[model samples]
Target: MTKILLHGCCGKMGRVISELSKKYDNLSIVAGIDKFGSDNMGYPVFKSLDECNVEYDVLLDFSRADALENLLTFSLKKQKPIVLCSTGYTEDQLQLIENKSKELPIFRSANMSVGINLISMLLRKVAPVLKDNFDIEIIEEHHNQKVDAPSGTALLLADSIKNSLDTETEYVYGRSGSSKRDKNEIGIHAIRGGSIVGNHDVIFAGDGEVIKFTHNALSREVFAVGALKACQYISKVSENKLYNMEDVIGLDF
Candidate 1:
């Protein structure tokens, strides 16, 4: 069995993973860490990682970015692999993750849905072919409670397209003043509303035709399933490196 240390056990994603994990015989949440402890959770929930005494093979983190430092510290000290599913990390924190990955296996992804990663792969292949003739735009929608604008998945898609192109391009987040849209600009727009699990649309517009790729997450289970997959992959891998959804899903980004 893959023993899991579930971080942010009280949060939405954490709770979803916890409940869904029960269906899998090979996965078990041995312990949980959350600032707000819950008495109802079948496993023990501690206020901090320092308080956790249970043995777990891997740590699955769905907490906020602010908790990353402590999480990384504990994981490194314990020599446990970690799957980071949090979003909205700053540049410095991201660099820290990369640096620490040299010591222990670390799995990180902006969006854990397998569908989203496949979309990223498709974008990388298609962007290079259409860059010269097509203008691209990305639209993402999430719940209002999400603190970060232009969900990380949006940026991931944009980066996939950006990296695939030979020429330089810029991201324009939600248009405004009368300046016409630039040819090399990739527009990204965000929509916030009630309880949207997640939605993304990538539009490639040419002179005659418009092509769009879309993915809609109806529930949180998609991410929970992906996180479990990552946890399983990281626990077995010996390499100490920063892995992403591409690595877990066996796809190249």
Candidate 2:
């Protein structure tokens, strides 16, 4: 079995991963790290990595962005590969991840759902073709309990679209003022209510033609499954590089 150290072990995603690990013969959670240090998983849960003494092969963090720096330090010091699925990182914190990846393998993605990653690839192909005439807008929805707005998947989708176009683009989040739409601006809107798992819709409008691409997540298992696949892939690879879902899926696991 590929032993795993699961961070954010007490949250919803953490619990999802814990339950899903039991179904995978090759993956297992050896220990956990959560702010509460709750030991509900039968494995020891440490409030801090400094107190961790268990053996594991990979670190799967589904925690918040503030927890990233410390997690990266511990993972790099211990020579452990980590799967980073957290979002809402500042520019400096993002740079920190890039810097640490030079030492150890880091599998990171804003969204771990395979479908969303595949959509990112498709956005690259279509955005350029539509950039000249079509105006692009992104709308994302999630559970009311989610703390971040526009969703990480929304920003990832935007980045993929932004990279394809030749012209520079500015992201306008939830526009409010009485202003006209600009050609170089991409509007991102967020909706939070009920228990929606996840929803993202990307629209390209020009003249009389419109193109819409959307993905709806009905269950949280898709992300958990993707994370496990990544963990399995990273456990076997010996490269000291920053990896993503593309790398994980490319391995054909």
Candidate 3:
């Protein structure tokens, strides 16, 4: 069985993950970590990862990046693997995660939905070919309470397109007076309004045609289930590795 330490197990997504865990015979959340005083489903909630006494093979972290450093430290000390589902990390923090991948298996992804990962791979392949003829734009909308703008999945999609092109491409968050998009720019837009779970649409516009690719997340449970799948996969992987949704779904990205 895949014993898991589920961080942020009191949150909405955490509850979804816990419920999904019950459906699988191979996966179980043996412990959880939450805020020091927060109650979390009767599981012993440790304020810090180092305080946890339970034995688990891997960690499924749905907490914020502020808690990442401590969690990663604990994982390294225990030589356990982790699947990071949180977003909004500064560039330096991201660099730290990449550096730490040299020692442990870390599966980090902004969006764990299988469809979104496939969209990323497809954009990478199509961007370079349509670089000159097509204008690319990404628009994402999430719940009003979402703290981050231009969600991590949006950045991932933009980065994939940028990397596929041979030359550098600028990202245009918004266009104001006297500013026109450059030929080599990718526009990313964010919308926050209601309780919409999640929505992403990428539009490729050319002179005569426009092609749109979209994914709608009807429930947060998709992410929860995806994270659990990653937890199971990470529990069996060797150290010194980096993985994403493509690895979990066995697709090329």
TM-score: which candidate is best?
Answer: 1
lDDT of 3 by residue, 1-253 (tens): 9989988888788888877788899878888887743564645677667678999899889978888898789889988898899999889988989999889999999898878888889998888888789899999999999999989999999988988888888999956768667888789999998998999998899999998889999998888878888888888887687888888888644
- Candidate that would win on lDDT: 1
Instruction: Score each candidate by Cα lDDT.
Output: 0.94, 0.91, 0.86
Off by over 4 Å in 1: none
TM-score of each: 0.98, 0.95, 0.95
How do the residues 1-253 of candidate 2 rate in per-residue lDDT, one tens digit apiece? 8999999999999999999999988888999999787857868899888889999999999999999889999998899999998889888988988888899999999899999998888899999989999999999999999998879899999999998888999999998889899999999999999999999999999999999999999999899999999999999989888999988767331
Worst ten in a row by lDDT for model 1: 244-253
Residue 120 in candidate 1 has what lDDT?
94
Cα TM-score of candidate 3 = 0.95
Q: Clashes in model 3: which pairs?
A: none
Pick by TM-score: 1 or 3, better one: 1
What would the per-residue lDDT of candidate 1 be over residues 1-253, giving only the tens digit for each residue? 9999999999999999999999999989998998889988899999989999999999999989998999899999999999999999999999999999999999999999999999999989999999889999999999989999899999999999999989999999999998899999999999999999999999999999999999999999999999999999999999999999998778544
